[model samples]
Target: MEGDSKVVESKPHLGIPEAVFVEDVAKYLKEQGSCTCEEALKKLEENYQKYKLMEVNLLQKKQRLKQQIPDLKSSLDIVKHMKSIEGTDTTMTTNFFLSGALHAKAKIPPTKEVCLWLGANVMLSYSIEEALGVLNKNYTTAISHLDSVNKDLEYLRDQFTTTEVMLARLYNWNVKQRRAAKATTNGSD
Candidate 1:
C-alpha cells in the first residue's frame, strides 16, 4: 500500500453558488440601502426642523407688521381729527398725561403743527395730509412684504412635503428588500 499509488478524490472549492449568492447580495444591498436611507432621513428631519423654525419666525414677523399697520391707521385717524380741531381754535387747551398714563393728567397748550417720526429717530414737521401719506405708504409696504413672506412659507411647505414623501418611499423599499432577502435565504436553506 505504501509503494503503490492510491487514487484519492480532491474536493472542488467553488467559492459560492447561484442561490447563496442571490441571497447574500440581496441581504447586503438591503443593509447598505437601509443605512443610507436612515442617514438621508436624519438629514431630512434636520431640514424639516429648520424649515419649521423659519416658518414660525416668518409668521411672527408678518404678525408684527400687521400689528403695526393697525396701530398706524389708528394714529392716522387721530391726526386727521387733530388737524380739523387745530384750525378751529387759535389757543387750544388739552389735558396732558404725565408718564404717558391716562390716570395722571395736566393741562397744556396745543400748537397747530405736529412732529411725525419718519424712521430711525428721524422726525419732521408735516401737515395732516403729508403725515397721512407717509403712514399709508408704510402700511402698503408692510402689506407687500407680508405677502412675500406668505409665498416663501408656501414654497417651504411644499419642499417639506416632498422630503417626507421621499423618506416614506425609501423606508418602504428597505422593508420590502429585507423581507425578500429573508425569504430567499430561508427557501434556499
Candidate 2:
C-alpha cells in the first residue's frame, strides 16, 4: 500500500480489468449469507501460510548463495597470486638478457636504457599488484553490501506480505458481515 497511488496511476489501463473484478467480487460478497466471514478468514489464513513457506525457502537459498561468496574471494586471491609470480618470472628473464647484452659491449656502454627498462618493469609489477589489491577490496565490499541489502529486502517483503494478508482478511470479514445483516433483515420482512 505504500506506493499504491503511484502504481494505480502508472498502469491506469492495465488495472481496469482487475478493478472490475474486485468490484464484482465485492457485489457477490454483499449477497452472501452469514458463513462468508468465516470463509474469508480461512482463505486469508491459508494464503498467509503459503507466503510464509515461500519466504522461508527463498531465505534458505539466499543463505547458501551468501556462503559461496567467501569461497569465490579465496579462489580469486589464489589466481592473483599465481599471476603475480608468473609476471615476476617473465620480468626477470627479460632483464637478465637485456642486462647481459648491455654489459657485454665494453667501453662502458651507457646503462641508462637498461636502467629505464628495469625501472619500467618494477613499476609495472607494483601497479599490477596494487590493482589486484584494489580489486579484492572492491569485491569484498560489494559482496558485503549485497548481503546486507538482501537481508533487509527479505525482512521488508515478509512484513509487507503479512500486512496485505491481514488487510484482505479484514475487508472480506466486513463484506460478509454486511451480507449477513441484509439477509436477516430481508428474511424478517
The predictions' CA RMSDs to the true structure, in order, are 21.7, 15.2
> Would you estimate the TM-scores of all the predictions?
0.61, 0.41
Put down candidate 1 lDDT per residue, 1-189, tens digits, no spaces: 543432221211111111111224335446666656567556667766776777788789878888887877776776666766665554444444356556544332344566776669999998767877877787788778878777766766666676666556656766886899999999999
Clashing residue pair totals per candidate (backbone < 3 A) = 0, 0
Encode model 2's per-residue lDDT on 83-149: one tens digit a residue.
5555233322221234645633222221211111122446223344454565576568758756764
Clashes of 2: 0
Once fitted onto the true fold, the runs of candidate 1 whose alpha carbons sit more than 4 angstroms away are 1-35, 90-112, 117-125
Give residue 71's lDDT in candidate 2 (0 to 100).
54
Q: Which pairs of residues collide in candidate 1?
A: none
lDDT of each: 0.63, 0.52
For candidate 1, the 10 contiguous residues with the lowest summed lDDT are: 11-20
